[model samples]
Target chain A: MGVGTGNTVLKVDGVTKTFGGLRALDDLNLTIEEGTVHAIIGPNGAGKSTMLNVCIGQLKPDTGTVTFDGEVITGKQPFEINQAGVSRVFQTPAIFEDLSVLQNVMIPAIAHRDGKFKLNPFSILEKQDDIEGRAVEILERLRLTELMDKHAGSMSRGNKRRLELAMCLVQQPRLLLLDEPTAGMSRHDTNRTIDILKQIKEGGMTKVIIEHDMHVVFSVADRISVLARGHIIAEGTPDEIKGNPVVQEAYLGGSVE
Target chain B: MKKFFANQWLVMLVFSAVILTMPIWLSPIGAGYPDLLQKFMIFGIFAIGFNILFGLTGYLSFGHAAFLGVGSYAAVWSFKLLTMNVLPAIIFAIIVAGLFSVVIGYISLRRSGIYFSILTLAFAQMSYNLAYSVLTPVTNGETGLQLERADPRIIDSLFVEPTEGLPLTNFFSLSLSGYEGFYFCAAFLIIGFFISLRIFRSPFGLKLRAIKSNQTRMQYTGFSTKPYLLSAFVISGMYAGLAGGLMAATDPLAGAERMQWTASGEVVLMTILGGVGTLIGPLLGVGIIKYFENIFSAINENVLMAAYSGLPEGLQHFLVTVSSPFVGEGWHLTLGLMFMLVVIFLPGGIMEGFDRIKRLLMKPFSRNKDAVESAEEGH
Candidate 1:
């Protein structure tokens, strides 16, 4: 069911993206309501990551327009889209390897507050009290305050993934796009991440997640979209998608749980 | 412990002490000359600036010498046209070089990695060719730009009458020559080092490091890296320009050859040799290369022979012959060998070497502390 308040957050309309002869996204159309978690689950070649990339302006779509909060964001730069209150946690956990966890988290918050380019070349980092406070608060919320000074590169994969999430969350974006948040984590880590996702859900920031883990998918997603061959095969609640034979045959391997 | 080492004032104190006492300390190594020490300060400024761009952002610009050359030209022009007041010359040089870098950096930063390096290298070569050939009216071409008694010093003439001979570049009555010029240049070097230290600790500097660490993450994090990159480029250009300004202030000559790619490569070598992205490592590199350039290059066959005269007659002659190539005309060979060894053994440069030694020295103290802590735990 939709939000019923009729508040549409991200609208992907007639979006077609192609790689030579192969269509990665074949005129895919989808709508995400405000304050909801929409999970896109699909097979390997179903273009889930490609869809997220197009939405985030990392890849330009061929014959369609993707609008965010009614702003045409199809051709905008990634940083521009990001500045417009959209944050994405990369699939492979992109982070500033040379910096500490605190710096990794602080960068996004500074960018968000200071806009695309602020020439504060002389302003000391430690002197930015507000930014430091916000960054510290977010790291604390993510239970990463203990490891704040550890190098981002040296962090374990799960912790790095969490740090990436903290980076995204620090911006307090209107829309958060996560690509496979729990992809390579242990079940214990996966469960902890699910708790985090659920915790953020209470804050009412709309989330568009592309996930493969069925457990993570069902645990946090408010709604589900089953994508197959660059198109949505079915769209409904997690329970409804679990019972959908088309999704079961295509992605769920004829059974879920 | 890290905080104590990172204390900015303490670092600055040590830096000033070492730089100010260079004449006394470097005397033992036969490099205490004011001229040689001035070269150290000037190149130290250049290397520190180069480190800001290359060290922080990982943008290996091979055209920095163009900015230095531009600074030299601007400074000399100021001496000829405006004033020989080293203050105006330095300021004018910085402004000109900064604008020059803005143009070059804007275009070069459009590409990244080796392409950026190539673009910068090409721009420098273009600048050199222009100055050496086409821009003869301004640069004086191959003969180089020099001050003549006939030329007007408009600002200097306002306060004092023209002299029989070309007067020295001065601050009020004090001539900027010999140790005076070295101290003048050293003052700029200290100020430049302070600016660099601030940049390294500043959020802006951290952002540049982020660009080096992960460009994709920076872009996605909503940082438009071009402004940050261009600012670094321009700042380093100004620093190179400052070095050039000091050079002309002391000698009042500008040559197109200063923009050669070899000169640009020298700064890169200095930065890497000392330690890229370090506060004092670039200065250490400058000290090493300039020391070799001045001292090692002066050691002739006669000097080597005299030093080894205490040895056996045959062995003395043999030792002099063996060590001769690495000195005088072959000083560059020693520099090359040293660079190679550093690159292979100490990739982090002299700073890493210092760190290793410090750790080695601290081992005994740490072991005692560890033993004491373990005994207390057992109790």
Candidate 2:
């Protein structure tokens, strides 16, 4: 299978990261095209999440460069990287649980428009109807409109994950990163997440998803990369990745289909 | 403008009404005196500013009293060299305190949680020591910085005689003393409250709350949390400075003890005892603590006996004996007990208690509304 027809949006070349004696990411290279869903699948302790962290500026690699849309983002602050059009959804759903669901989504939208900092201490926040409208629109699409007034921490796990996604999507980032977005979700919730992701894919936003579920992997990924021992072992289309013996032995373990 | 007033008119009305009538109403409770009332408004401003940082951002600075002391010094110096007018003194105080906070906040914000608290505490203690010893030439040593009659008052000498009794802080010819002083403080208190209200309803305020809720999530959401925290810190320090300036404005004295760590701790107690994150909580805390300090400490055995004279002799004796430890010089004991009770039963402080009571009172009305809604749905 051939790579998707688009320019490279993100490039991770020769990235190596170490935590004391353990090597988390070792000379890893990845190229994700714009407007495509790329899945990085690996077994536990295989550095899939670590690579995602490196890409998102959460962890700096000992040696390598992370270029997003052609500008280097390595060693940039997380907020700076996010400002550069990269957004991430964590494995455990990092959300402002104390704030209402509406607030949770509105924050990123505000950040997207206002940049890193804007001190408008006198303007009433409620008067920003456009921002509120956009937040509500995203909530409606995520089927979270009914829960907009509810505190995000009180939501069920599935809803929390969806809210986290809504937060990222509200920013309308050019590149989205998901670290095991469907890690602990139920099958029904997993299917629902897949539907949402498919809708996002149709919007033409580039995505890098680290998922373990083969069903999720096969359903949404336009291209697949298998990782093992802190290195990318294989890269291809889903069908090619499924047939590749090295990917099967290293991560897939057997025929996934 | 109408819309803005429409939203805030009730708060403004109530605040003005309460502060304006405080002198009249407090007389009944033996707290109508200018000195005590001035303390209320000054500390009320301090607590309100402290609430902005501690309440919104959840970064507790234990060195806030340093700013307060700095403001007092700046204000006193202004009165000595510049003018006896309170305006320049207040402005100088706020700017000095703001600069001090920028330095301290920049260093303290590097570490959050308990470390931030300790760093602030260290800075305040250091300031206190420096003021008491090495900075004596500036601070006037342990006797504290006092306005001297011999000091040249360029502005005051041009207008009035310097040989006159202590030069009082004034707004033009209107002296900042007696009922006028109380009104002056009350006006500033209203301004402080209004500013805090605006902040509470602003996007900047929302960001501060977001920081309080989750700093890591805020950073990932593309917010540089440090600058936001620093802004809050400086704003809070300016508030403390304003309070200090007001204190010096009224009394015309600046003491090293004002910058002590305990003074910082007092503001913390005022904030927490009032409510950590509520708009009106810190002011209420200030009122309660100041009331206890001024009124309760004045309640001697004779006053207690007079209050309990109607009771049976044995019962009155027993009551006074049991209560003696919690009144007069033991007023701190009462404050401590109240703090413990509030912390234990109302973790959200006095505002939480008010909220609980308000909820309990509104329970029946809310249930009726729910019933009406359900009936409409059934129809």
Best by TM-score: 2
Ten-residue region with minimum lDDT total, candidate 1 chain B: B1-10
lDDT of each: 0.92, 0.91
Q: Which ten contiguous residues of candidate 2 chain A have the minimum total lDDT? A: A248-257
- Candidate 1 lDDT over B1-379, as tens digits, reads 3575468899889889989999999888888889999999999999999999999999999999999999999999999998878899999999999999999999999999999999999999999999988999999999999998978888888888899998778866779889998898988899899889889888898899999999988888898888899999999999999999989999999999999999999999999999998888998999899888888899999999889878999999889889999999999999999999999999999999999999899999999998997899799
i-RMSD of model 1 (Å, 1 decimal): 0.7
Off by over 4 Å in 2: A1-5, A254-257, B1-6, B368-379
Mind giving the per-residue lDDT tens digits that candidate 2 earns over B1-379? 2254447868799889998999899899999999899999999999999999999999998999999999999999999887899999999999999999999999999999999999999999999999989999999989988888888878888878776677777988889888888889889999999999889888899899999998998888899999999999999999999999999999888998999999999999999999997888999999999999999998988888888999999999999998888899999999999999999999899999988998999999999998997899799
Off by over 4 Å in 1: A1-6, A255-257, B364-379
For each candidate, what is chain B's TM-score? Answer: 0.95, 0.96
Worst 10-residue lDDT window for candidate 1 chain A reads A1-10
Q: A225, model 2: CA deviation in Å?
A: 0.5
- Give lDDT tens digits, candidate 1, residues A92-171: 98999889999999999899889999988778888899999999999998899988999999989999999999999999
TM match of model 2 to true structure? 0.97
lDDT of candidate 2 at residue B307, scale 0 to 100: 88
